[model samples]
Target: MIHENPPLLTRIRPWVFVFDGPLAVGLALLVGISLVTMYSAASDYDGRMFDHVRNLSLAFVVMWAAACLPLPWMMRSAVPLYLLGVALLIAVALFGDIAKGARRWLDLGVTRIQPSELMKIAMPLMLAWWFQNREGVRRWYDFAIATVLLLVPVLLIARQPDLGTALLVSAAGLYVIFFAGLPWKVIAGGIVAGLAALPLLWSVMHDYQKHRVMMLLDPTSDPLGKGFHIIQSTIAVGSGGIWGKGWMEGTQAHLEFVPERTTDFVFAVFAEEFGLVGNGVLLLVYLLVIGRGLVIAASGASVFARLLAGAITLIFFTYAFVNMGMVTGVLPVVGVPLPLMSYGGTAMVTLGLGLGLLMSISRQRRLVQS
Candidate 1:
């Protein structure tokens, strides 16, 4: 039974083949950027860079496991996962730990979990599954039903006062519905209706949420208070100018002027260090990843896979756009993190799962064609 050693690629094909090539490369680039940016941003905080590495490693493993799962199995588990997520969200609402004035985490004896993060993936999954089952015979009311499915968890998350997660979940589900053939008029009407309901929405919003919007309108109104974040972050971004401050030389980050340097405002650190050119490169990588996701969705093996892949792809876009917009003071701060760039375990894990699902869909398409 003695034999010569197998070629290196042959030995690793099973592992390597599990991921889509372009998507893997795009993620690797982002991960490398995250490490480099975090090193500078977390220089004053001992062990923060190490913790980021650990979080990234966990995210990579989660993504790999998700990529290995069969598409049929993913579809089969969709309903149960969605139900479990909703149940956990309900439980969190009933008896969750309040942290930073928001009840978003459920203490599960051993560790705490954010059920809303689960909805970021589960919402799209459930909706995709629903639309897939109704393919070729979908009615307008089917969209209505899908909207209800989307809203239940969204309202729950919003009630947790995590507007950021709620918005992300809503975007994820809406993308699925749109790709599943939502009408243009309906979308137009929804937008108009949403605009009409602004006053009501404002009245219901928490005071802090209202403050964020006001700060967006004028950060100088409370420069030393709620508006400080937008003020400081915009300085970091604009200070970068054309060629950047050259890596670790970023004054805003080094001087601790940029708030949340390691998390939500990491983009400000990145922008200050790398400047507009670096932001362009980062955005290109994101676009490549997003383009690969769209390709996967277009070539999906089933309607379920298509809708899920498309929704997940757009969710990545939303994360990046919102984070950067807030950092640049163009949009209201909503606590959204830069995808694959921010330093947080729960969000990283959720993003990894979404990426993994994309890989699975991509790999499945290849398998069928082959």
Candidate 2:
């Protein structure tokens, strides 16, 4: 028998089915916004805009490849990835290149890699795998062991003075443990203990870290120095008013008042150009992505899938929340970039890996059900 070509959509359905619809829409919107904002934010820096686009394109590919992997393959690979990340962390501690007073990068003969970024995905993967093996028989000690696993890479990253990344990694692993039936009383007790340890935490903080906290409390104390970032970013955010200054018309970014306008503080550029209404729309898009992720997590076909999906979802939440909080001057600047919106290869890749895992879990669930 001879057949004519299939309908256009029918021919493409297999490719389209690889990604979750809502998640893809949300990511596309954010990426579009990132491109627009980058055009304005990086206008003064030749080639920066092209670099941003390249990074984002690479991220998209990473996400696509990740989504194509089987869940069983992901589970089988978890321990090896986790072990590799930890070993890399140890190597970083011993011989990583120092940049801006932080030893967070390992210089290979060709390219430098940030081992801590690997931990961002590996931590949650390892924890989810651990809990999946325990399944219904989990106990308090399981959590204790998991906590220890979480702390190793966290302490290593923190030793590099990369508090922002360490915090993100910690949150990722904790989300897995929490979703694996961690007790509420234990959570409450941990919070209480954390609060009680504030004094000791303060005593051990690096000088710059302490300064950041102080600046958060009062930016004017050192307005021209350590506080310049907060002050200028907050101005950019507030000056946008209800409707924003209009795209590419933002003075703070174009005038060079905002620091890191294309990277960590890109939100300030966005707020300045798009205004309050724009911020609301951006937040709504993020919420849509987050909501879709949680839905995927809830429908996960196995315990491992559920925990990994949930942790990865909340990790996105953490990225956005921390980045916006610091830009608005409500929190200390910890160098957390806005997810999918910031201009950085490492973060984009890490986030892409996360998005891929979410899509994979979601696709797997649909496959099993159908």
Q: Which candidate tops lDDT?
A: 2
351 Cα displacement, candidate 2 (Å) = 0.4
Q: Local error of candidate 2 at 20, Å?
A: 0.3
**Candidate 1, residues 168-201: lDDT per residue as tens digits?**
9999999999999989999999999999999999
Clashing pairs in 2: 244-275
lDDT of 2 by residue, 84-160 (tens): 99999999999999999999899998999999999999999999999989988888899999999999999999999
User: lDDT for each of the candidates?
Assistant: 0.94, 0.95
Where does the lowest 10-residue lDDT sum fall in candidate 1? Answer: 12-21
The TM-score, computed over Cα atoms with residue i paired to residue i, of candidate 1 is: 0.96
